[model samples]
Target: MSNINVDEVEEQMEEDEFEEELHETIRFLLVEFRGSLYTFTKHIANMNCERVHRPLNRRPITSRGYNYIHKILKEDPTNFREIYRMYPDVFLKLNNILREKTHLQDTRYICIEEMLAVFLLVVGHNTRYCLIRKTFERSRYNTSQNFNKVLKALNSIAADMMVKPGSAVPEKIRESTRFYPYFKDCIGAIDGTHIPATVFGRDTNSYRNRHGKISQNVLAACNFDLEFIYVLSGWEGSAHDSNVLTDALSRNNGLKVTQGYFFNATSLFNFFLFFRIIYSIHYCGVRYHLQDFTGQGRHPEDAKELFNLRHTSLRNVTERLFGIFKSRFKLFKTAPPFKYTTQTEIVLACAGLHNFLRKECRSDEFPVETEIEVPPSSSEQVYKDDNFGELFDTQEQQRTNTNAWRDAIANQMWSDYDHIVNKS
Candidate 1:
């Protein structure tokens, strides 16, 4: 065998081994190529499937979304303080109120807390439904239904939430040095604000105010504590405060005015006629004193000026009340795009909520939250003759009687005030 070409035998064996290795390499390469092609096909199929089966509006909150909610509304006590400032019992009592009143049942997807979160986002943030729908993973219909449902529930509770000044309020005025005898009988201050609103029709002009925007002239009365005692909204923005007051008063058991009480008034209403209409309700408003009398004009020359200054000062409660209301709800800050009727209901709802918060929270005033900074104010009102002009005495007799009563109160204020000059 050794002599039979052993070297040749070794060389042939080496060639065969090389051929086997080449075949193995080709087989490996083919397997790898087929595997890569299969992967590519699967990727393309996934893309096509995604396009065909799109996402639905009603879906669960993604993991990231759940994380965000937890971040804002913490599980522990550390961050809940911030939440309480928006309104105490926001998470606790609000859900109860809604659940008790609203017929909406909680499903596997939506819960009471989720629905309230959506409502508050609209009120506190003035967020659009579409944006909230996206965040909560709720259908647009779901968002709208819950929002209006809560709004209706809030409206239903407005009257109950209102703080009536009639209950032991005059005593507060009687004891106050800022008001004293002049406003001793005063229940509150009355004024009208232009809240921007939108409407469609021939009556649209009626909804537009002097600012040339559509709004409602909302009449509200507030007391020393800066609580709204009464609210009369839904009048055409063009409606005068005096006219609105008349309508409210003329209704059966309407805005009942106590005899001998007074309301610090402003130029927005006809003070002279208002007194005659309510007959028993006295009118005490800021008087125009042309005299820069003492030259400094800081000091009042007569009782009327003093009364006017005091009236302006005390009546400022209503202004502060409005600031609180507007600042709290974004819906009020911006022009609300609802029908005139809905606009009225929104006003009442907000006012009721305001009173409810004030009574419930018992804070000096609504803390200006940095979350809502300088919301836009809407304007809507139209100038027209007051509807109640002829309802009361146009005669000078009641006018004279009102002037005499007001003068008596002013004189009493002047006499009562301790005057002393700091002379050196």
Candidate 2:
């Protein structure tokens, strides 16, 4: 027994010596390459290996994890709704997608659900990473890392989720007496709005809008059902809607409206340049119809006025879409403190989430509150209407052609309205 005890003590002392040597080696390497990142990274890797082998004395990750998250989700669902901006089933679906995409290899103690929560909380509320870290009892680095991980996962799903609904104007939109046949060829509405952005260098000037806020001009297209079909974000705030629209249609991977189908956006229509598009407002003063159709938002007096009125009413859904988008994802109203590149990614990621939540919804009532108004065209200043012909276009021939087309549509709408009113 004494011999066995002595041998055990000797073996223990040797193990201690080996551990001390390992520590000394690490310390020496760190000092020798105090500025070398590669060596420092290797040192951290070795330490992490030790940690994996060592019995964990640290408390379980609770904040971004099961300890607190699971409790909140199960015990107080309303609180869960406030933080996640979504219900449990939606959260669970996104969680499953993250797990499936990441193959459950995220071993950083942050579960898939927690990662998604961090992402939504960050973008939806524009909360800082430190607050999230405290909420989840995680380090700031872990909070940010998982936020990005989940963000990328959501972006990956955007291509699949943000898609055309096979039929742009469904039976419901087509059957409405106010819109039928008049807008049968119309699939959706399109428009641009500004989101605050932070960028430095020469880019600062380009992104600065007349409102004096640095922003990114984002163009979005949504169908009548209030679902986003396409979104093109990340243009400089100074970029005209026409320029942005031109670029979007020019890109091979950009928005594609079928040959006959169209989306209503406010831009100059060039018969040669735009074979598939028609401007919602006139290339000239024809916007009066669209404006009255918006400002007072009353029924217009003439057939032409009535046509614009109905068009504006239906097209306003895109504006409402933006309102809901900004309200639900507050990060969009303010510049999120991420790199400009990541900021752009966040924009697209949030849109993807919007579509995801919309698809997952089981009820008809929209959960997000949005008090919407007509935003200025790329031409409006300080939310006030302003003519942008000097900045846009004023071609006589295009104007004539547009007026002719609208006149035909107006006559048709008038005939339909007369028949409905007279019959009644």
Candidate 3:
């Protein structure tokens, strides 16, 4: 009985040892499996982090924007004007001027030409920045920044480009038989035009014109050459032409008229105060507008008619200038959503650009055609006579003398015109 009991105890002890060894193996396998799983998770985490921090590859190595510009400038040069609104040489010259004269500098990635192209596309075509970004292959931030920089650069040169008129008579007047001696004292033409504007709040009412259009009234003076001599912008469309002219005269750096010389204008400026300074024919119940004499057999009937015709022809220069200006820069055709101050600056900048283009490329083609008809009651007239100093005692006397002088000139013109017509 003792031997059997001892065998049983030994068997139990062997079973206990086998169970302990199996438990140890299970724990070891579990630890090894957990370590392998942890390593796999770490690898995946590393790959995900790399992907999250990767730089975007949007623009290609050889960008389409750069390629398009290169192609146009090199292979397709003529299209440059269509795209940029100026010839290659003119554009390059302007770019150089901006670079040398202003604060605009080329970035490592973008050049001055690209910057200028962006600006021209915006102002010339009134193109949106999104399209410009795509065309230039630049980010929105870069495109907008460059545009503003170019604008500032252009403004810096405005003073040099938009110069005051010289005292000498223009060649158009000096050479023309109809105008030479008659308009010898005339320096240029003055007129008021409306430019579309965006206004808000109480300002909207002030900007609405007689045509029921929201616009800004711009008073401009131009020589017969279709170049802007003075430009006064930002007045509300509801403002009178005479009031605008008054404001221009009031400003310290406003339109400067030479003594004894005058600017031809419309009857809108026929005020008692301006009679001595400006000359307007008596147009009440008369045929004075240019459109009246357009068709066949529309010759002047008398001295007043003849004088009206001559005055309208000479003053038409200002209208023609406005036509060319609005045609060349389409930005003026529509109101861009910008600050009023910025809009005013744009007008001044465009005026400077017009003068620059006229001086640089005399034959630049204007794409749009414009014909301006002289409205009824819009008789061309003339303004500040410093040359007639001490000639009259009072304003009334000055006005009387001005009217008499105008009549004498009209009679002389009529005599010469009648003789020529009879001879012909």
* Candidate of highest lDDT: 3
* Runs off by more than 4 Å, candidate 2: 1-64, 101-104, 268-275, 279-299, 362-403, 419-424
lDDT order, best first, reads 3, 2, 1
TM-score quality measure for candidate 2: 0.75
Worst 10 residues of 2 by lDDT: 267-276
Clashes of each: 6, 1, 4
Instruction: State the lDDT of candidate 2 residue by residue for 205-243, as single tens digits.
Output: 999876677999888888877778888888998776666
Q: TM-score for all predictions? A: 0.71, 0.75, 0.78
User: How accurate locally, in lDDT, is each candidate?
Assistant: 0.65, 0.71, 0.78
TM-score order of candidates, top first: 3, 2, 1
Regions of candidate 3 where Cα sits further than 4 Å from its true position: 1-71, 272-284, 371-394
Candidate 2: Cα lDDT at 356:
77
**Compared to the true structure, candidate 1 yields what TM-score?**
0.71
lDDT of 1 by residue, 99-165 (tens): 7765645644456566666666776657887798778666678788767766787787777777765
Q: Model 1: which residue pairs collide?
A: 208-381, 209-381, 215-380, 237-381, 237-382, 238-382
Q: Pick the candidate with the highest TM-score.
A: 3
- Decide which is better by lDDT, 1 or 3: 3
